[model samples]
Target chain A: MSCWETLADYALRSVGIGERLLPRSDFTICQQVVLIGSGMIWNVYFGVLALCSGFFLATAVALGKASHSVWLRKPSEWFIFIFRGSPLFIQFFFAYFLFLSLKQVAPIFTPFTSAWAGALVVLFLNTAAYSGEIFYGALLSIPKGDTEAADAYGFSGWARFRRIIWPTMLRLAWPAYTNEAIFLFHATTLVFFSGFPAQQQRGDALYYANYFADKTFNPFIPYPILAGYFILLTLLLIGLFGLVNRRLNRHLPRERRAKVRFRPNVIR
Target chain B: MFSYCADPDTLSGLTWLSCYLTTGKHMAFYVSFGTVLLLLAITAPTALLFGFGGAAAARARFFPLRWVGKAYISVVRGVPDIAFFLFFVIALDQGFEWLRHKVKCPDWDQPIRQGSDFVVCDAAKLPLGNAAQWVHETYGFFLAVLTFAIVFGAFAANVLFGAMRAVPHAQLETAEAYGMTQRQTFWRILVPQMWVYALPGLSNLWMVLIKATPLLFLLGVEDIVYWARELGGTKTPRFTDYPHGDWRMWYFLVLLIFYLAFTRVSEVVLDRVMKKLTHGQATAGGEAQRKAA
Candidate 1:
């Protein structure tokens, strides 16, 4: 078939849209590109949804960890430890099996078995934990002078937190938060590789890359395409985070405001 | 493992649980945990060596060599590691085979990549096509180790490069004034001082390296994740000696506990090592130790 026809047929193939069966033989570069690109839709969906939701949850967790009350601090500590201490790969497997058993107990909650609910839940908790640690560190490192200044101005409790603590925590945490966001996107590729089944053959970019590699007995093409897409996605994420980091550090003097340096070497 | 535990069906309750937990499959699962430790033991030193070489090359006066080292760090950091795992395993396998084909089967001259087939002469195969299963497994484990080393070496190189830079410039200048060669100064002053600066980043890398051991399952190694899924699945009476319901949840929970414990222990060990490395250094940790003394 022509490249256009193949594109038309397999454009949404990852979501089980156009084609009932994946191309078995004579796998064209066009088909690989189209299908893998289609599969990227899921990766983007998982990364975007998880990061957006995880951001707010992470902020709450960071604050909870910083709170003076034992009630607030302990649970947040445990949550961060549990998620951050384990491998994301195992988290995916554990979450999948947990959700599977949950499904058995309550078929009404069968939605948990689907990647949308199950994997997203895992990603949400995982990122929240990681980002929580980052934020907690930032919270602790927030200038004591800032808090003292707030106290001198009579800003107390909620007002103190709102006007002083929260903004400074975010500002200090933005660089590390950007790193977490990038790695979380990288982690999303592991969703399908986890125990979470890709029902209807609807999988992510890595999933389809593996599929094509297996089919053609050639790992060269499909994986590189997936890598290319991820590079683009990662660059886009860097750009987005840079904008936010700039805004967060806007009030600081140019020398004082920290730049968003890429430091993937020191993994969380 | 016990004489009394030979017959599993005869046991019940806690006894049954004891025998079940000590089964051959479970022993392999236990060994897989050692496999993770073994990977760390080997990969850490090998990656460090690779990183040392890369860092040395980057700090070299030659422009092309510096660019090559910089490229190694940047490219690996740029892409997801899973992609590298997926690509390198196959590419390395094929590259090895192609080399063997050229060396071992010089007379055979058909194309290697005819459509989808990567056919070299039978003699050119890795492990010579008739090697034992253990050899194949060992070969795969070796590939996985090399892949891990390459990816992590770049991170280590970045850390080491920074550490090299962080070494006191005055020390190097003093060595030069004393008529010490560049190599002598690097060995005596730079390398010694760099470790103190490198320890924090290296410790963090070590934790990451520990967490990444589970990806061995993706490379088809019979790691803990692999065995957990295998041994935890529903086993029908017809299919096996012991029949059980789906217990993957419990199995995965056990894996989770294993990883958590591994990470916690590593954290303790790494923190101690960092303390030892920082002793008498110019950093804050060293200053704190000096104060305490």
Candidate 2:
């Protein structure tokens, strides 16, 4: 079969679109690329949705962790600790089982058994906890002078937070937040391996890579394709975050602005 | 283990529960936790050594050596670690076998990858193909350790490289002024000073490594996750004396708690070590210690 024909058949295979069954017997390089590329769609979807939603929740969590009220502070602290302390793999397993039990109690929530709902829920909470810690550090390191300036201008509570505290916290946290973004995207690969079942073979990049490897017993082709897609994804994330970092640091002088660089270590 | 517990059907209440939890499979479950700790104990120092070598090479004067060092760190960091875990195992296994085939059977003239069958000469097989099951299991564990070390070594190299640079330039210059050789200055001043900066990143990496131990299950190791699924699945009465309902959820919850506790203990230990390392340094932690003392 021609490359275009192969591409057409497998392009949407990961989402259960074109082919009802995956290729059996013979596997080709084109099929590996198309299927793994299709699988990357799930990775991007999970990462983007989780990070977008986790950003706001992480902000709330950071604020809660820093709140004067113990009621607010304690829960956030434990949430961050529980999620951050455990592996994402275990969290995926624990969440799937917990969700399974919850569905047993309430049968209407059966959709939560699927990867889309179950894995996303775990990723959301996990990223929130990690980003919450980063934001917490940033909150603590926020310049005291800014808060004093806000107070002198009669700013208090929401006004102070909106105008001064929040922005400063974000600015301080942006670099670590970039790291969180990269790691969270990488963690998306763990979704299929955990308790969450990929319905109809609709799995992530690593999932499809595993599928191809199982069929052919050849790791040489499929694994590298997955790696290439992820490296590209990481580069894309870095570029996007760099743009945002520029915007966040826009008010500072050129010399004062911090240039965000890849640290290559995931801080759990 | 008690007399009443011998016949699980006859027993009720806590005796049955105690006996059930102490079954052979459950004993394996308990042992798997030790496997995780053992992996961490072995991988940490090995990764650190790899990191040290990589960092040194990256800073080497030779261009090719520097490029190789940089490539090692970047390649690992660029891809998802789980991919490396899956890819390296098979690749390394095949690589060793291919080498063995070349050395053992040079006259044997057949392609290894003939129609998806990686058939090396029988003598060239890793563990010799007919080795005991334990030998195979040990070989797998060794591979998992190698994969973990290679992946984590890159992160450690990145941290150590940063930490080495963070060591104040004046300290090395001062050692030079005192007539110390480059190597002596590096040994006495640079390495010592780098530790304080390296501690934070290394501790963070250590926690990540701890959490990553569960991936051993994916690598086909009989880890806690493996035992959890094995023992927690719905067991029919025909299969066992003590059958149970679907309790995988509870089993996973237990695993989660185990990891959380492990991570917390590690954090405490690492925090103490950080404090010890920071003593007499000019950092914030050192100054706080100085004032308290």
Candidate 3:
């Protein structure tokens, strides 16, 4: 078949949309590219959904970790420690099995046994922990003078947090938070590799790349394509985060504004 | 291990648990933890060596060598590292076999790439086909280590390269003023001072390396994750003496705790090391220590 036909047939193959069966033999470059690109949809889904939702929880977690109350502080501290300390690969395995056992006890957890719910939940918690630590560090490092100024203006409690502290905390944390987002996106590749099965082969970019590599017994092509897609995705994330970062620093003098350079060593 | 424990059907409580945990397969499972530690032990130094070489090459006077080193360091930044782990093992295996095929059996070449199969002559095979089981396992382990070293070396190179630059230019200028050769200045002045700047990044990299140990399973080594899945599956009484319901969650929980505790201990040790390393250095840590003194 022609490459165009192959693209049409397999473009959404990973999601079980266009092609019912993957190309078994004579796997064309077109087929590999289309199928793997299709699989990126899932990666984006996992990364975007987890990051957006995790942001609010991470804020809460950062605050709880920084709070004076023992009740809030201890659980938040443990949550960050457990998630940040353990490998995400093991976390996925542990969570999948935990959810499976939970299903036996209560059928409400049946969805949690699947990759969709289970892996997403794991990524959500994992990103939250990493982002929480970044925010907490930022919160701690927030200028003492800024809070002192807020107190002088009678900004108290929630208003102090909302009007004075929150924006500054985020402004300080943005660069590292961007790194967390990129790593979290990179980490979405691990979901299928864990015990979580990709239902009907509806897996992520790495999953489809793995599929093509297995079929062709050639690691050269598919992996580089996957890498190229990820590079673009990483650049896209940086650009998107850079826009927000600029807004966060808009009021600051140009010299005081922080540049969002990609630092590679931030992953826990 | 206990004589009464042989009859697992009759045994209960601690006795039954004792027999189950002592099974031969369980011993292998326990040994796989050692495999992980061994991988870390070996990979750490090898990767640092690779990173040192990469950083030095990046700083080389030759343009091409510098470009190659820069590419090696930056490649990890764009892609997911798991792709590198999966790709390099297979690629390296084929690459070695292809080189061996050329050297060992040049005249006897049927094409190496026959459709999807990488059909090299038996002599050109990694462990030479009929090698002992341990030889194959060792070969596989060696490849896994090399793959880990290469991927992580890039990250370390990035750290070391930045650290190298962070060593104040005035230090190098003073070395040059003293009529020191470039190599001497690099070795005596730049290298010694870079460690303080490098420690935070290196410690962070060390934690990343610790966390990345589980990816060993993906390279087909029967590491802890493999054992957890194998041992935690539900077994029938007909199949084995110690049959149980799916206890995979518990097995994985134990693995999780193992990693958490390992990372926590590493963090504590690393912090102490950083303090020691920065004791006399011209950095913030040193400044703080001076003030405290």
In terms of lDDT, which candidate is strongest? 3
- Give one digit per residue, the lDDT tens place, for model 2 in B64-108: 999989999888887777888889888888899999999999999
lDDT of 1 by residue, B109-219 (tens): 788888878789998899767899999999999998998899899989989999999988888999999999988998988898899899888888888988888898898
Which window of ten consecutive residues has the lowest lDDT sum in model 2 chain B?
B1-10
Q: Local error of candidate 2 at B227, Å?
A: 0.4
Tell me what TM-score chain A of model 1 achieves: 0.95
Model 3: per-residue lDDT, tens digit, B129-149? 789999999999999999989
RMSD of each: 1.6, 1.6, 1.3
List iRMS for all predictions.
2.1, 1.8, 1.7
Q: How well is candidate 3 docked (DockQ)?
A: 0.71
Off by over 4 Å in 3: A265-268
Instruction: Give DockQ per model, in order.
Output: 0.65, 0.67, 0.71
- The TM-score that candidate 3 achieves is 0.98
How far out, in Å, is residue A121 in model 2? 0.7
Can you write out model 2's per-residue Cα lDDT over A1-268, one digit (the tens) per residue? 8789888888887788887788786777888899899999899999999999999999999999999999999999999999998888988888888788789889976877889988898899999999999999999998889988899999998888898998899899998899889988888998898888888888888999999887777899899999899889988988999999999999999998877777655423
Model 3 C-alpha lDDT per residue in residues A1-268, reported as the tens digit of each score: 8889988887887778787888788887888888889999889999999999999999999999999999999999999999999999999999999999999999999999888888999999999999999999999999999999999999998999998999999999999999899998889999999999899888899999998888888999999999999889989999999999999999999999999988654234
Q: Is candidate 2 or candidate 3 better by TM-score?
A: 3
Q: What range of 10 consecutive residues in model 2 chain A has the weakest lDDT sum?
A: A259-268
User: CA lDDT of A110 in candidate 2?
Assistant: 86
